[model samples]
Target chain A: MNKYIKLMSFLLLIIVTLTGFGLYKAQASSPYPELKVVTTDGKPEYIEPFHFLGFVSDTQNYSNSSTIVFKDGHSRYMEDQTFLERIDFNYNPQLNDFITDHRSFMRGKSRRTEHYTETEQHVIYTGMESDVYWNQPSRGLMTIAVLNKETEEEETFSVSLGSDGSYYEVSATYVNYPNLTILAATNHSTDISEQFVYTFDVENPTEELTETINLTQEIDSNGGVYFGQSFDRTERFIPIQSVRQTDDSEFDYTEEIIGYFAFDTQMQELIDVPLFEEDTLLFADNDKLYVGKDLGDTIELHEMNADDQNLDLVGSIEMATPTIGREEGTHYNNLFNQNITLLDGRLYAYETQYSDDISRPLFQITDIKTQETLFNGTIEPKDMAKHDSTNIDVFEFRLDTLNN
Target chain B: MKKSLHNFLKFTNFELERLSKFLFALMGITFIANLVGYIYTPMKYMGKINEYIAQNSATSEQAIQQYGPFSFYNALNSFWIVGPIALGISGFIFYSFFIWYREWFGKNTFAYRLLMLPIHRMTLFYSKLVVVFIGIFTLISTQMISLFIGYPIVSAIIENTYYVNQSLMEAVQLHPLFLYLFPLDLGFFLTINAVGLVVLLVLFTAILMERSYAVKGIVLGIIYAVVALTLVLLPLFLPDLLNNHYILYGSELIIIEAILLVIVAVLSLFTSRHLINKKITV
Candidate 1:
């Protein structure tokens, strides 16, 4: 009995001694670390601090309807009236026609179409007028710019536009040595009958072009031409031609997809491959081209040997479950909706489900070699819409092996 | 086999009878402490709010909004509530070692009588483990029942508007420790208890090592403990030794832990049986 009492007291003593040392260490150390704050203009400032919530994916223009509240009892409401007006216009065409008739009362403006071309270093924005007014013809204008993402430095590249027709479309193809930008233009007509193709060097945009391709024969009446990069980093001019047939009535016409032809820049010939509606091109490397297709409940990733153009079967992963709270009457397609990217021999797929109840975003990483799922987890974002549709824009997907 | 089973059951019941008074006292104290916390927290909070209202002429709603409503968070954070849990865990840890030591060190020399029983000595080790297991569940059940009983008394005192009330299951989910003890998933609850059983078995083997070697037994016990812990944790670090390093999934990690626990249990029982039959001083 005495020995039992001694053991009990000794155990209590050890526990108390260890707990006291722990408390002393905790008191000696600072609870919160010092935080460094920087202003938008790269200058440091000491100011009232606020906790940083996570960033929201500003996709589908949902940010316009979002509300931001600060800890200082200040709240800001964002209401995008233009987006509401656009939805209203789509639903009621008669109302749009009535507004268009009263051009003097309404703010009527000519419509312009813009194309965005993105590379690793630069984002090129080009806009062109679609319609010509009475007695006024649209002229072609082109501008080039260099944007450094790391330094946030932007400089306008010197450019000279020819006295030609209005530029309708622009395509950019990046290669190893000299990148090229192709511009297609036509005179004041809706039909692309007599079109001119002009190529410019991306690096030295100021230099005048010594050679021009008179592609009137190459480009058919209803055909579209675009520039793209092949799997081997070779620049190819792809022309998607269409066949048009007149119906019994002179007013009606029918157009069918003939085929897509790739014009090799170096070989100066066409490369032909069978095109299917289900096979959508996802990514291309030097020797292989990755294509994705929907297989009922799962998405199968297939690799096409770009050398021989033979398609081989790859593994598949299950598609995300649908949102529970989607509107009853609304027709929502849940096919090919996930964002998938292949980087460093690994595939990353992100799927977000949004309904009237809750929003959850799931991310998965799979190794391409083993075809095994390496990681699968949910990403929790602050202020996630609990009662509405969510759009998660994945702007960048990178795997940093060094940090891991 | 029938004789062994009968002796095992008899020894387990005897251990329970010996510790019943101590176990009941521990449970009573823990329950009273937690009950006091559950009642005092809301009363103290409402007093502060009333004082604030008297000084500033603030509405009850305004006061509730500014200084948040009485919640399960308040009850969980109360020192009285936490103190009982800490005390229970500490007492149990000490009792686990004491259960084996008491037989050897007691006035009546109980170890000699226990070993002299014409039964498999492994049954004796297992009987003590079963007693400890039953004690743990009883204490947890006592704490849960105390919370259920104390919650209504608190709610009756504090007005519905002044507090955010939760259901029994919701309150259990809100508390981190209670969520594991009374898990919603049956598999998770079983997994947690299985891990606890493995830890108890390891401690039993360490205690047997001490009883076998006497003065040199303390060092041997510590060394045995370190080696057992290292073996159990090898799976977690073994991947790093390979060229193609990969992380395991959650299910795979659980499987590895289960495998290691089995290995530890087998090794512990084997070593403990050898010490009991061959090297034990009694």
Candidate 2:
């Protein structure tokens, strides 16, 4: 031992220092202080089962971000010491599907919800494959993969887009057992884009039928079109919106919704939906479509009329425009797209409301039918001192249905 | 089996002793540089902020708003922070070659005595590999200590008002390069180190090839390294090469990669053992 003193001492130093550091880090548990959603008013049980997960980014250095989870009235770090552990914390079925199944993995994470759909009998994935080089004549092909859930077999095929125009995007996909419907937006050489609904058989996908929605005839050439939220695979209708940019100047511009049409996948026709006010928020969950108008003190939600396809008054819920500290100019707000999430007839509206005086993640859940505010709260640190150390706020939220 | 195990341990300790001075010097350089970075970077920032306040007649709040809050991550960006990192990396790389070559070229051609030992020649290979692995973890441990010591000192130097407290996890998130080298996640850390170990094995095998074949051996060594690296990187290229739109899942890709790593590692070790035992003319 004396002869090997140098080796022993060096080994001891490495082991002790590393072990101590590991124990300290492990004991610390989290970098940010523990946070909890303290309900100031309304029923807390409404949001008791749901876990809101999002990232808290440093406003000063946007690059530095941490995953935060608000659940069971308390907030914790979503990302832990391991990759699999972090995945387990914010578990998404789509993400889980991607890992477990090769077909989902090939379709990619971004399109896991929109361009992919799964039924009890069949799982389907679609994407637009186009030549990336702009100078060359682009060959756009619709790539499709269908998996039979019962047999555990997958059939993959691609159909060409006729060499006329490049189909750059597949916006929405719907699975109806034997038939798989895909809504793709194509960009032509003349700077005019077109939307086409491509329907295919799951067994023989090469046999394709495409219908081009004449958007050029209905709306202005300069306007852009997009599909509303179609998260559910069984959704029958995809709400399409065409908006033209109204530019007052180089900096000031607003998009005006010129045309709102619902593309019924079963009927194979576009039904015109009456356009609401320009500022109305449009979101669709499953087959039901709703437009929300923020009226300062209350948010008025109007659902689509089942018979006429016109938006009818559903009900208005109580809500206040979130403000920062008393010093108004020292705060920032970044509301995510489709901030209002309607799940099981319950509206979950959330956004990061930040201020130097009080930074909190504010969320309010309302029962759509009863027009009653079920849960209203702000996520904050247990200790005010903890809040001062790290400027933490939730950037997004999801219901804990997937984990359950 | 007991005798071989004993010889391996003895050789590992001997190799570790041989590299102790170099490793310690690197560790000291890393500690001092990181420590200075933690202190100097923030002090410099505070000086600039004070200068700004004096020049603009602005409050500390306004200055903080403009420059942003100073955190441990700010120190990470300083040029001084990379000194130890660069030294440690280059030292290990240079030593990987020198570890084998020195046995042949050093006083009394030490390779002859080492190979002539009663124990298996592969023990020498395993021992050198172990020392390299030890030296890397030692440097990592030293860096961890530096952070533990430096974070509080920096908090004091910058003062609580200006200092933005961040967890080590948050620090790594901000600077991704640290997460790759010194991952907090045990699985990730092991995976990264496993890759490093395989890479070292390949390099050692390449060095042995040079020792065995002389002039012709240099080209063979380069080819051998290229083949090993290509096999390791095959998983990444397979999707693109086959034009199959990433048909492989994450877990499958990882499994394939792990298998390839094991294969490359085993082949390198076996080839090295054969070269050192039979082919080398010492």
Candidate 3:
């Protein structure tokens, strides 16, 4: 009995001692760095810090996305890790069907004059304004319809304009005649709103005038037109396209190719810029467009004039090669996408690497012109152990200015 | 061999009869604790919400809508729900060690009597193991049954309008312990139980070692336990270490874990059988 009491007491002491040691170790090894902010005592500021903005999207699910913008050096040491904005691109098929059905009703009533040209083979339609319809109180839904004058086969595409009118852009591409009406509406509803339609005649351009009157203006001139060009004027325009691969497989994937376009909002004209399919828009500052292309181990950068739309070859930076693995010894390899942002003339590229374990962000920053790397590191969140599965695919990184 | 099998069954029955009162006490205590917690927590919130409504007439509807109803989810947050689980787990852990030590201690010296039985010495070890396993399962089953009884009692106390009622299965998921122990997946539940059995076997072997050689066996038991624990955890970390990077797919990881679980269970049971038959002191 005495031995039993002694054994129990000894075990209790060991447990208590170990627990104390663990707590002490935890207190000593803090995850976050100590922050020291320089405060001004009623003094005037001299130079303002540049703010960076970018977004991260789940490559697996494009709708599960977040937009983050932080000031230089603020986020690196801050305790509150909440993003500036988090957007879940929730796909509402019912809302989309509703918008598509009512789109002709909305667009047919628009007062904007329609422009058309006729060719020997095809009748080309251009500059037909469509009204944006908001069914839900928050999200603005807009559908654009393209009709083949020969077959009368109409194809419609819907764009979700967030509460802010600047969320998405309307773009149409003509491939051939049943294949001719390739109406693509890319949802770039993060920062800019500019619409563009690329039209090409397969044979000879033919003109046939079909009268479609703008009835909303006729019905009530005071009623507002919801779609077309953004109501607010902005200097920057970014057009992003999510290219979907139609290969018959379990993993239906979409890759985003961010394109840069300079729009004269007043003239309603898109400056025709030579955009390569591989080129992804990084950042635009001081009339200069920075674009990046993934070359496996490195990212090739190109500088283009935003005004004249001319491309200049900039140097490339080497990136960390992401380790790829097959799911259950299958042929399909995992998807990896990179997001880039420019701050203080340095380009910050974040690559979200996904595997069986939790997905973590790998970042590398470099000088835009010289292509010299400034810093390369990974941010390990404290709560990484909590998530046991790979659910997150997209992550956006941005920099925003601090309020004085 | 036939006589030994009969003795094993008889000893297991005797152990169960001896443990019946203790098991009942544990269940009764946990049941009362959970019942109080399920009733008290929501009633306290309802009282506070009602008081707020009385003071503020303008926002009464909104306040009632937000906080008036007590739910099974709300009851899950109560100490009674979590406390019983904690108690059961702690008690099981204590009894795992005590189940072996109790035979060596006390006036009768039950270990000597147990060893002197006409059955094989391993039969004695197996009987003790069966008792502990039965005890653990009983506690888990009792907690589950208690939850079903507590659910309706909580619903009756709180108004239906205020509470967002969930089904019994949903309520089980809301509670952390119930979610882990009573998993919807049969394979996952079996896997967890298999791992638990491995742990019990390893512990039993360690105790037998300590009983054999006293102070010298303490060092041996510690080393044995550490090695066993490392072997059990090797599958989780081995692939990454070998490949020089993390690339194991989820399905591959599951397969690795299953293989490791089988290996560990076999090793633990084999070691315990050896220790009981050869090394253990009477």
Candidate 4:
């Protein structure tokens, strides 16, 4: 019986570990998976569940810097840097959240945040994190798993950053089962003349290579620059986030995640209007897109469509930015972050920013074209939380969505 | 009757003093930690408040005008957890010490057999319980005294702890004795909890004295402990007693504790009386 008990204990340990590892292979993880669990919306082409569902395949290798030994006695992994890694066992058993740094070097002082909300059902695991070297950004990546944990499934898609100092962010997700995983910002840059990059599958080895073109256009000057995800020409110029360098002169570059309330790349693109406070997105009676922005006082709404030819001339609704100031420095600075939303068939816009007393996400909806107030209301910033993305500061302010 | 009463008084005093000695030594550590908290908490709160003002660029005039006095209410609440932690550890340590005492007191050695001389064994039981109660009293008092010295000074460091406005000082002053008194009351119930505990201790002691082997003592101790727990649990788990307690509030824990005590005492009397009467070559 003693021997049997020992054997059963050993088997339980093995099964639990194997179950975790098997799940790991299916969830495409980032360098910091604790950070990655926050994404719920799928990005364009990156799709939902960026794990195993793509066409091409490739493998990269890296060395283990720490002499840490695994319980399995296996000391290495399939050296892909972009694969998101969980902090070495610092994750908690009950909460399934990162609790500490597992690496011996990071003992005592933890550099990672532990608690995160999974807005959608996408899986990501951390692979590793390294200190910034020379002028390079901190090295990390998502280990894209091609299978789903629930379905025992297999997928064909696998891709990686083509250049150094470039990274992908999985930003949003949908709540439904077999949830979609989205990817934002690939390492590849775009040239206007050349539209796509082509590559062939590794196993199947198709005769022809695949093509990818990241098409983006800059629209206005709000100091908050953005990139548009939609291919629809009329809605091409919305803003999401303003990128600021960590250090002006250093050789290193790392993406600092901040909050983005007004950063929507396609929010103002279709309407040719600045997304003022209290602008709303509407589907219209004909199912054409419409948006509103509070210009000065009376709000304006613009009739919008995805058609490229007549995109600019779509008439707009008009509104105003409320001229209210603080009565005793007690009020918050309600400025900067903007939201242009199209819920159902109506368009709305809102503004929320930061102050000492109050710093959170809140916005309004207005007319699409004229920056006019169709109506004004505040939606909790967390409510309008972007799909599948953790750092709303980078892509959240820019990505466009039809509110579900 | 008078002789038995006299013997009980002597037995209870001796045992209670020994328990106090152990508990008093433990409180020496509690007092030091509490003193450290009193000095350290104010300094830490001031540091956080200073950082907040400096980073946000605020002045003293602005702070007083904007909020109120410098009172670290949140920081004050942080140190309050120490009292409970100290009390809990002390309680466990005290219980373990008593278990050891029970074992040592039962052997056919100089101490155990001496106490059994011309004594109603009930006197010995009351002595052990009084000792436990004394130890609990000393430990609880040390914890409360420490927190009383710390909370006010820490609260004063925040802009407005509002505790002062809410009559916190007066409340603390009027009820300082209750701080030690409440836990001491729980300690009484806790000491009473040891009735079955004493039986297991005595049973382990008896078996160990007879058997010269190490396994007998440990194995017997474990078995006795388990049996004691089950017996003590009977009244709590009995369908009728449970119904009275849970549904009707018609029964009291003392009644349950008394029944268990009586059974253990009866068994202990018979075994000890037989063991004393039987001739054993020491």
**Candidate maximizing DockQ:** 2
- Per-residue lDDT tens digits for candidate 1, residues A1-404, read 34244224333444554354334434442211111222222112111111111123222222212322111111111111232232223112222332333322222122211133334443343333322222234444444443454465555443434445554443323332345434354543555534344555556665443225444455453543322222112223332222344464778655444543344443344444445575343444332445556454455677755456676778775533322111122111111112445544555555544544344444555666676655554433333343123332222222222213
lDDT of 3 at A378: 41
Candidate 2 residue A202 Cα shift, in angstroms, is: 4.8
User: What are the per-residue Cα lDDT tens digits for candidate 4 across A312-387?
Assistant: 3344443223421101121011112223434333343333333332222223333344444433422112322221
Judged by lDDT against the true structure, how good is candidate 3? 0.49
Query: iRMS values in order, in angstroms?
Result: 23.4, 4.5, 21.8, 31.4
What is the descending lDDT order?
2, 1, 3, 4
Q: Which stretches of candidate 4 lie over 4 Å from their true place?
A: A1-169, A172-248, A251-305, A312-338, A348-350, A353-362, A367-404, B1-68, B72-282
Runs of candidate 3 with Cα error greater than 4 angstroms are A1-404, B58-60, B65-69
Question: Candidate 4 at residue A52, lDDT?
Answer: 12
Q: In model 2, which residue pairs have backbone atoms overlapping below 3 Å?
A: none
- In model 2, what lDDT does residue B120 have? 91
Q: On residues A144-231, what C-alpha lDDT tens digit does candidate 3 reach at each position?
A: 3445545655544433333443332223222234222212222343222222233223333223211122212222222111221111
TM-score of each: 0.46, 0.82, 0.45, 0.34
Taking all chains together, the TM-score of candidate 4 against the true structure is: 0.34
